[model samples]
Target chain A: MTEELIIAGFGGQGVLSMGKILAYSGIMQDQEVSWMPSYGPEMRGGTANVTVIVSDERVSSPVLNEFDSAIILNQQSMDKFEEQVKPGGVLLYDPNGIINPPTRKDINIYTIEGSKLSREMGNTKTFNMIVFGAYLKIKPVVKLENVVLGLKKSLNERYHHLIPLNEDAIKMGQENVVSILEL
Target chain B: MAEVKLMKGNEAFAEAAIRVGADAYFGYPITPQSEVIEYLMTAQPHLTTGMVVLQAESEVAAINMVYGAAGAGKKVLTSSSSPGISLKLEGISYMAGAELPAVILNVVRGGPGLGTIQPSQADYFQAVKGGGHGDYKMLVLAPSSVQEMADFVEDAFDAAFKYRNPVMILSDGVIGQMMEKVIFKEQKDRWTEKELIEINGSWATTGKTPDRERNVITSLDLDSHKMELHNHKLQAKYKQMEEEEVRYEEFMCDDADYIMVAYGSSARIAQKTLNKARAKGIKVGLLRPITLFPYPTKVIHKYTERGVKGFLSVEMSAGQMVEDVRLAVNGKAKVEHFGRNGGIIPSPTEVLDALENQIIK
Candidate 1:
């Protein structure tokens, strides 16, 4: 099955990097992927978003209409993309950022206090990894080993020291996955 | 050996053009495509032996410099975004008329008047239909990946020389900024001393042509017949190119119940939409055209005979390639269109919905 997802937030939130990690994981899995982001001014805090599509076959479109899943890193993201998620879709929220939580029963909503968790993990930047972990527990697109490989492939060769802690963040997030769907 | 590295489309293009032995670069800075010049500035890009890089006064001056350099038979290139590309059209027309060889790159952005700086496929008609004046066509190459962005550098140069024309690499801002792993090939061929005859010899306008013959490269043939003859010659070249250069990617089209037609960055979007459609057992496939001018007409038409349902032309423009799709489909299958101009991208959901509403019906 092919999974199409969108990650949205303000600029400098590393939304694009999150997509990169997922896309890289897809590459390691031998799945076809295309990660596309808004260019120019959108990167300057004006509602940044990226769309990543992973499929068993060659991907056709980089745009998505009905998302199987989404990661809302901020309140703006939740407000904007709340209408687009498909029924039976997965919505992972950072509880510290989202102002209005979802009240949908047909879809799965996971609210993780990623900011606190990431800060405790020694680097708030690992918020992305925490969300990735939750997705791993629920969706499991890539094996843990392959994901580490993808991480090394994406991370800077100079900053290899941060790899171990990022791995811990993923593990922690995976264990705390929140399920908010009747189904 | 040319080492391969993961690079953005813009930087890779600059690297590729320089590697292909381009002797001169003339351009002004513009977003999305700004990295092209940015990379050039990092390391002075020169011809293998000797080349020149001139940051022109404006897009107009840049294209004119291209006109001058290419007229002299020197490998010259320039790049810009949609607004800048529009300014270069006049120079593009001049190049076409003078039978000059140059490579022009358009890192497309949303347009119509200083549109958004985002990636856009909206310039399809501007590149294909000759956005400039008079009767002419630019050999437009639409590259979807960083690899093609690199590989097409050589192809564009060769195509320019082979046809005595200007070639444009029409890329969107997304393609320009997106980074990917690329494997570079060994570059062994380069412009030899023999290739510099017209550029460095007595052929250029040095006022010395009067002794040999007037080296006038003008399209103002007052005689309609002579001008018609020239036009006829360009037509023949374009026809030959269409036969030899039509390139495209056909994905899962062997048994597709329906086909989607898209190009450049939009084709990538189409790929994602096809996957979603396929998961629902829709039997949808994609036809991604690489060469915008020498469009893969025959390959796209092949889908019609075997109950290929219909074609959905997804572009960033209103409906340029849609016309070509209709012509290729030839009433065998209905041709529909979906577009979002001014820098907006059509969501994959919207496209699938369009496909369901227009084609699957």
Candidate 2:
């Protein structure tokens, strides 16, 4: 099985790190993975995006024009990646700063109030883990145990104490995500 | 599995350098590849492996530092992007003329000037055709994945010392910035003083001794005849490399009608194109050249002789390696170039469309 995903948001939204964690989880499950980010000056505070591919076989390309799923955090990303999602794919987004929500009709659309949930959890930094957890819920390609292992691998040991909190955030996302359209 | 981890390509290369027992790393920060130096600094190889990691004031100074360390029989390395590499070219030429063994990395960006910081394979000519001023050819290895980014570090050092020539890992910004799973090889210990004497003592300016004369390292020769002889010697070593070190990978070529020749990140994209084309009943294949300097000329000729219809040379440049592909084909098959400049990477379907328009039609 292969899953090509794009996670996009404003800089410092943990877009790249979320993709990195997903890639590490793929490695934990003995799958091939690649994470390609749109980086440069635009990353100062502008929109940032990353393409992540996880596959049972060797991944052929890291850069792609289309994605099986899109996790959009900001309006800029939602507007940019809405049409890039393949038909019959998933488009998950947190309606935090989004002025223009996705209008695609051929793909499944899901919304999670990531910002609202993270604020309620008393940690705004857990926003990315919430979105990531919601994405995993939509498509359970990797196991939750593997996701925890991946978090351990990607996070520094000094921050290991926060893994349990991040896990709670992810679980929150999985439970609170609302499916808007299923075609 | 031996210590597999997901790492960015530039970081992987830096980690591999420390693991492969490189004596020193000297580099300046540049966009898309600054992580090479950043990772080295954070890892503190100087404290862990006793490897020196210095952020030079400039790319030129970094390369000269590489030359100095290499002349002393140290496994030295330096890395930069397109503009920075241009600054390092003179020092690179001097090292090549002096026959010093060093590893240089050019994580290329789109350029004629400062250009875009995004990924591009525009430095193919600069890399394989000797970007520096001299009659020299550095062994160039193009890595497509983070794994190879780590793996080629050991291979490049081996080739550099074997030929007493500079070796370059020609990676683009895509490979430099992208993250992938990499399995590192066993860590190696740096060369000892006695080992350095045994391995590179004949020419390296290690030290003057009572039994052995002081070794001199210089690229300058006032005598024209002597300079011509030096050029010939360098040419001979390049020829040896061509014969022995050409590396390439072929996919679905045995029964294909068309061939897409690419390297590095372009090759990775073309592999996806190959799959798409095959699914659509188009017989297309890919031949990815691993060593750019060696050029893989004979292999292209072999494919031509085997009745491949045409070749589509995909790069991230206006067209550089395409010229080499044409020369290798020798008019045996039609060769066309397709690319997007200014740091835009073409998609798989776009490449396949170019193949159909430029080659198949």
Candidate 3:
């Protein structure tokens, strides 16, 4: 099985790290993974996006025009990537600052209050983990135990103490996601 | 089992230098590749392995430092992006003339002059042809994945020493920045002073021995006749590399009607195009050249002789490597070029479209 995903947001919104964590999880499950990011000056403050591929076989293209899923965090990313999702694929977003929601009719659409929920959880840094957990809820490509292992691998040793908090944030995302449309 | 981890191509290349027991690294920071030096600095190979990592004031200084270390028989390397690499071309030519064994990495960015910092394969001609000057050629290795980024370091060093010629790992920003799972080879021990004397002592300026004449290293021979002979010797060495070290991968080409030739990240995109074409019942294949200098001309000629309808050369430049492809085909089949420039990566669908319009039509 191969899952091609695009996670997009403003710079510093953890879009790249979200993709990184998912890629690490894929590796922990003995899967092949590739993470390609939109790098350079635009990533300093403007929109940022990452294309991640997790596959049972070797990945073919690290740069792609379509995705199996798109997890959008802000309005700019949603506007840019809403139509890039493949037909019958999933579109997940955080409905915090989105002015226009996805209006597609051929795919599944889910929303989670990632920004609000992250604020409530008192740690905005776990925002990406929460959204990641929501993705796993809809598509359980990897195991939760493996995600913890992946977290350990991706995070520096000094940040290992916060794994439990991130785990809780992920569980909250899984529980709080609202499926608005499923076709 | 070896160690496996997710790593960026630049970082993987740096870590492999240490693991391969390279003696020194001298480089100037450049976008899309600064992580190479940053990783080495943070890893502190100097403390652990007695390896040296220094940040030079400029690209010119870094390449010259590489020349100095290599002339003394040290396993040395330096890395830079397109612009910085341009600054080092003179030094690179000097090393090629001097028959120095060192590795230079060009994590290429879009070119001409201080172009964008995004990935581009426009350096194909600069790398495989004579980038600096004269009839000199650096053995060029193009790696498509992060794994190959780490894996090719040893092979590069091996070929460098075996030929006593400088080798170039011609990567681009895409491979340098992307992260993927990599399995590293076991750590190798650095050569001792005695080993260096034993292995490279004959020609390398290890030190003048009392029992023998003092060794002299120089690339300058003002006599035209002597320089002509030296040029002939360099051409012979390059020919030997072409015969023995030509490396490439052929995919799904046994019954293919059309073939696509690409290298580095362009090859990865072409693989997706191959899959898409097969899904549509088109017999398409891909030939990925791992060694850009050797050019893989014979394998491409083989495919051309097999009556393939057309050849598509996909790249990230307007058209550079396509010239090499056309020469290889030698007018035996239809040859076409497809690409995007100025830091844009061509999509697989667009490449397939180019194939249909330019070749199949």
Instruction: Please state the error at residue A178 of candidate 1 in Å.
Output: 4.4
Q: Distance (Å) between predicted and true CA of A129, model 2? A: 1.6
Candidate 2 CAPRI level: high
| lDDT-superior candidate, 1 or 3 | 3
* B1-361 per-residue lDDT for model 3 (tens digits): 8867999999999999999999999999998899999999999998888899999999999999999999999999999999999999999999999999999999999978999999999999999998898889989999999999998999999999999999999999999999999989888888999999898888788989898887667799999999999999999999999999999999999999999999999999999999999999989999999999988999999998899989999999989999999999999999999999988999999999998899988
Model 1 chain A worst lDDT window (10 residues):
A57-66
lDDT of residue B83 for candidate 1: 95
Clashing residue pairs, backbone N/CA/C < 3 A, model 3: none
Tell me the chain A TM-score of model 3.
0.97
Off by over 4 Å in 3: none
Q: How would the docking of model 3 be graded? A: high
Tens-place lDDT per residue, model 1, A1-183, is 788788887777678888888888777777767676767565676778887877797555555666888888888888878778889888888878566887777888887777888888778888888888887787887788878877888888987788888789899899887777636
Q: Highest DockQ: which candidate?
A: 3
Q: Write candidate 2's Cα lDDT for B27-58 as tens digits.
A: 99999899999999999987877999999989
> Cα deviation of B133 in candidate 1 (Å)?
1.3
**How accurately is candidate 3 docked according to DockQ?**
0.90
True contacts kept of 2: 0.87
lDDT digits (tens) for residues A1-183 of candidate 2: 999999998888899999989998898999999999998666765889999999999999899999999999888777778999999999999887888888879999999999999999999999999988899899998999999999999999999999999999899989999999999
Poorest lDDT segment (10 consecutive residues) of candidate 2 chain A: A38-47
